[model samples]
Target: MNAQAFPPIPFLDLKAQQARLPGLKARLDAVLAHGQYILGPEVHELEAKLAGFCGAAHCVSVSSGTDALQIALMAEGIGRGDAVFLPAFTYTATAEVPLLLGATPVFVDVDPRTFQMDLASLEARIATVKKAGALRPRAIIGVDLFGQPADWAGIATIAAREGLFTLDDCAQSFGAAQGGVRLGKAADATATSFFPSKPLGAYGDGGALFTQSAERAALYRSLRTHGEGTTRYEVLRTGMNGRLDTMQAAVLLAKLEVFEAELARREEIARIYDAALKDVLAVPARMPGSQSAWAVYCVTLPDEATREAAKAALAAASIGHAVYYPRALHQQPAYQPSHDGAALPVAESLGARVLALPIHPDLSDEQAQRVAATLIQALGG
Candidate 1:
């Protein structure tokens, strides 16, 4: 195939996102004129809008998604031998924050289909930890994987029973909801990212934390800026430098205008992909009464060999594809201790077969159709 004949589709197209930038230039230019780049007016404006969108009382903007998690943990005072339960199937950052805070990340299996934390497994893990009488069960981090909100009601119920704080990792499912309740409002605190490729991305790295408690929100603000209570020099608590930049905040504020439209378009694209690929692959299962943001349109191939073959075929046909995570976080080098002597059949299996297809607001119907056709053809469906 001639490269010019069919231009390769990318997993994400930031250039297409750039075309929407002009709408915010006037607001951005005004910020530039004021020369107040850090903690500027736009920062509060974006935070307020995000808090309203998530139906939360407070939103604290931070430097990155990783920082958002770190701040949330700090605000909750989860540290020093505290045990934070997390799904073993998720990204490393979900578990890393706990370790960084001198806490232990207790790995739990995920629901085989939804790829979210398995509530039964989570409760079992918590009980086992308590029985051990060594580690303290302090919190649970429920990740909204592939843009679908986790079983928040179930997870939250378990957390409340165990007196554990819940942090909703909305990094991929910021706009998602279950039973009309948004992800941010589902947990004690919600953390989301704006890592350029996210559904509501900024120009660069950015993230925000949402909470309903006034005291927690105030603490998070202090944690984001090196724990300053009143003055910059006064350190009330140990904290990280996690302030979000003004420029990224400005870009996100502009992107917020069309976020709902883009979410709807993503859903349409996902439906098309699901219908076309269902016969050949295991399509993502949408839970009842839940709406996903569809951050990634992922499918599970029949096996590892078929997954590799399909990826090669997509490459040959100029279709874009990626593996959201080829390796489970528990299997990573840094998290070896957590995975030691643990057997997670579902997480390991999904890591071998899951593949993400090109999905974004910019993907045209024709492109989506082509991606579907190429996958089916590759799999000999």
Candidate 2:
């Protein structure tokens, strides 16, 4: 069949998901009826469910994924003169949080195949920071890029040796797992987003932190609500108003009912793309002994020219496509001044050539096939 035979495909079909969620309206109505739009019962309920789903001991809900990272770092006393390490290929939020917290971000290269932080690069970067002696080597944030788990086992070993705190930036990978266990318990602390496009997203901006420590959980709860002590008015320390909205929590709870099934659908769609497109383009490489949430199914072209050509072709075909990150964190203008002069070839190359195709629970088989065929044609197959 020709590409013109298929109708336009939405990058993410939230309405389709809403239609499948039978209790969505009731959940929203409950929030309205309760009249507790702030940190209400629904918020706690969602937090519990989220924690349980990931097999984590505690889940602290926050206003956004950025706030989750901030609160986690705050609890660890990360500030000026502290060196925070993260991958250069991930979203800005992972790097932004460190800079916003008055810390320096030591960007590291990523693996060409997995698009994950390179453990060797991470070790070398840590050594570079230690040798510099100007900044304290404080933490390592291993991002689960594109909904796939990072090498947590390798990251943990490095962190243990370097005596650095390990923060799992699981914003794109909450539902994912590593070594048969869910992602939440892989690091010292894990942060995840609930943006509408995420696998387990809320209606609006919301996020959460997961941990196995009761002490860290208590600190997170306090930090999220203005650092309160035993009493609400008694201030224990400086904090931010990062509470998740009750309405958003209500929405998440409704969505959570269908999350498992939706994840399965996403995996199915990803498999379809893998089988169809692998021969033509560089498909995403899954982590060993792990399952991804399949947030964004991206493919890498041979070079920048090939990507531009593909982009033009996809646009002409009316296919929904996007570049996840056009620039690595080190190349972005905001971080250029702070970025140490290091050539991260893999991250830079990925930023230039990668393009994401539509992959969601609502995408049909015909649409998936059309996407693959259109992309292959665009690549001049």
Which is the leading candidate under lDDT?
Answer: 2
Q: Candidate 2: lDDT over CA atoms? A: 0.92
TM-score of each: 0.97, 0.98
CA deviation > 4 Å runs, candidate 2: 1-4
Worst 10 residues of 1 by lDDT: 1-10
What tens digits encode model 2's per-residue C-alpha lDDT throughout 272-320?
A: 9999998999999999999999889989989999999998878777788
Candidate 1 residue lDDT tens string, 63-85: 99999999999888888879999
lDDT of 2 at 216: 99
Name the runs in model 1 displaced over 4 angstroms. Answer: 1-4
Model 2's number of clashes is 0
Q: Candidate 2 at residue 365, lDDT?
A: 90
Give the Cα lDDT of each candidate.
0.89, 0.92
